[model samples]
Target: MPALVLAAAQTAPLAGDLSTNLARHLDFIALAARHGVTLLQFPELSLTGYELALARNCAVTLDDARLIPLAEAAQRHAMTIVAGAPLRLGDDTLRLAALIFGPDGAIGHYAKQYLHPGEDTVFLPGEAGLTLTLDDDARTRAALAICADTGHPEHPAAAKRSGAAVYSAGMLLSVNGYAADTQQLQGYAREHRMAVLLANYGAPSSGWQCAGGSALWDENGEHIAHAPANGEALLIAERRADGWHGRSISLD
Candidate 1:
């Protein structure tokens, strides 16, 4: 079998700027393509920063035409792209979501199951978990998480029970929360024996100064790759015949 290459795009999103952020996402997709990445995940609320006040205005449905370019790029590159956004649920409900664009142009989404403190005011919590099978291979099942969801031990534990081999999270981690948040992810990887990946914002969003330490850990919980604390970068990890290897590439 071919190696499975996965990456985390640690981006610096502009607050409430969808057009500009879309362009940046395209650039990141192109770059990931050049590196033969098969799966790419972006930080939480990557499409419009973590600005709660603008979520409703920025929320998009699954059929939103604004996402056509992203679906097209996914098909063109044969890469599964998971980017964060605010999803429009019912007429007035909004949820923090991860929009998954498959290489076949099929769009699937995962709403964040856990909300941090004040988030309930703006977004509804998702009810179920989603595990994706990559390239029709059973060996590459990936489970998705968003921000605060990772803080709950049962989240990853349930993913493991669901047969996920990879646990991926998209988040906005401030400097004060980085250490504890990452420690939990690392523990999940070791405990569940699943490769873990974290994609965090590289700049401030919604008034929070984000810590840009996006990273990846092998199934054994060995820290394989990491970006610096304050810059845009791509954290790539590939599972080869020998083991999982990783590298950090500056996107700046």
Candidate 2:
């Protein structure tokens, strides 16, 4: 089998501006395509920033017209793209969600199962986990996670139980919590025996100064790639026959 290539995008999202951020996401997708990335992950609420008050208005459904371009890009690049946004199931039901665009133009979504403090004010916890089979290989399953979900040990544990080979998280981490949060992700990789990927914001979001150290870890918990703490970059990790190889591409 060929190597499985994945990328974690560290970006600076414009607060409450879905149009601008959507364009940025498309640009990043094109860039990742150029580098042969098969899967691309972005930070939490990347499409509309982390503004809780604006989530209700920005919530998107699967058939939203705005998502057509993303679906097209995913098909064009033959990549699976995971982008974060506020998802609305009903008038009062909104969840922090990861919108998944498959290479075949199919759209799937994963809501955050765990909630951080203060998030309950506007969002509901997700009920189920999502695992995606990659490259038509059932052995290559990638589990999706969002902010606060990684903080719960049982979350990744459940993913492992579901036979996921990779545990990928999208987050909006602050500078003060970066060290501990990333350390925990590394620990999850070590404990679960699954490769891990983290995509975090590179700039301020919802009044928090984000710490952008997007990273990837191998199945054995070895560091594969890590982005700088305060820049826009693509942290790419590839699982080859030899092992996991990685590189970082600066977008700034």
Candidate 3:
């Protein structure tokens, strides 16, 4: 298969501001397109800034008209964009989910399988695991994960079992928790023999001091690229003939 260029974005989303966030996402999409990124991922609850109190009111269904602009951008760039949002399940149930918009349109949705400290009160856990094919050869399968999901050993194990070669996680990690979470993510990459991509917040939101540090790791568990913990940036990784090479691009 050909080399795949992937980008993980670290951003500061305004609380409860969906339109502004969507516009920000579009800007990121345009930048990714300029860099020839095949896939782009954003942090958990990026659209609503992790405001659990507003989750229900902010939840969006798959058919929501607000997503039309994202769909059009995906089609225009021929790229796959994975963004986080509070998703409405049935009539009243809400889940923390990664919404994927591809060149073909809305391709897949992965609800967070694990919840953080107080998230259980507002979000329901997902039942099924999700893996998306990134290339026509079907050799590059990517798995979706949320903040707390990276803390569980079984989650990545299940994704590996499902034939995932890349593991992507979207998170909101505090300054004090970044070290531990990064160690755990590196361990997952080594144990599963899969490339890992992580997206995190760059500013305080929802009453928490966030640590950005968006990063990418090779299959051997080597740190390929990392953004700083205090700024908006994009970590890009490309799988090449030699191995995976990565770099961090400033979004500011």
Candidate 4:
């Protein structure tokens, strides 16, 4: 496997502000490109921002005007970017993870199979756990989802069953605490021997802070690094000869 510098852009997102959020996403994409990153992951619903009822109006088709610039950015940089957005599949609407243009163009898509208890009011449940292998850029057999999608075993475990080398979930969490959740997820990584990345939102919206503690767990489920509370940072790690070596990227 090639050395892939996978990055996650963690930032604050304002409600109903597509341009602001899109700009922030592009900024991070540029940052990652400068570092020679092969793939970059953004938080769930990163383009239009996460509150569903408030954002349904902004949701548009794949060719919608707002999404054009993002596609251009992906094409311009030749990087793979994953972000959450509302998608129109036939007549039915879905809250889907849009895996946009990469070296191979937009080749993969995954929908949230489980809608959280509170989220059922805004989004529809996605049926299948999607898996695909890109053009040898990264033999990524990944299963995609948003925050709640990772809580269940179906997504990650399904990826393991599918033989994925990596598993990812874009999230909007709270800084109040997700200690136990991370603990459980780490154990899953160790038990499955897979690389997992939880891309999260750093911004506080709707009175609760989006937990900014992002992590990368290697095959042994070792703690690569977790972000401290109330901060914007990137936790970077590399799979070296001995093991994964890492350092913090302070973006505050």
TM-score of 4: 0.88
Which window of ten consecutive residues has the lowest lDDT sum in model 1? 132-141
Ranking by lDDT: 1, 2, 3, 4
TM-score of each: 0.98, 0.97, 0.97, 0.88
Q: Model 3: C-alpha RMSD to truth?
A: 1.1
Provide the clashing-pair count of each candidate structure.
0, 0, 0, 3
Clashing pairs in 4: 12-203, 173-211, 174-211
For lDDT, the strongest prediction is 1
Q: Candidate 3 — which residues are off by over 4 angstroms?
A: none
Worst ten in a row by lDDT for model 3: 101-110
lDDT of 1 by residue, 1-252 (tens): 459999999999998899999999999999999999988999999999999999989898999999999999999999999999999975868989999999999998999999988889999999999998876656779999999999889999999999998998999999999999899999999999999999999988988989998999989999998988987898899999899989989976
Q: Per-residue lDDT tens digits of candidate 4, residues 47-125?
A: 7667667756766566567666667776677777787776655565655555455544454456677777766766677
lDDT of each: 0.92, 0.91, 0.90, 0.68
Pairs with steric clashes in candidate 1: none
Off by over 4 Å in 2: none
Model 3 over residues 1-252: C-alpha lDDT tens digits?
Answer: 479998998989999899999999998899889988888999999988989999888889888899989988998888889999999976678889999998877645899988877889998899988988887778888999999988889999999999999999989999999999999899889999998999999999988899889998888899999988887888888998888888888886
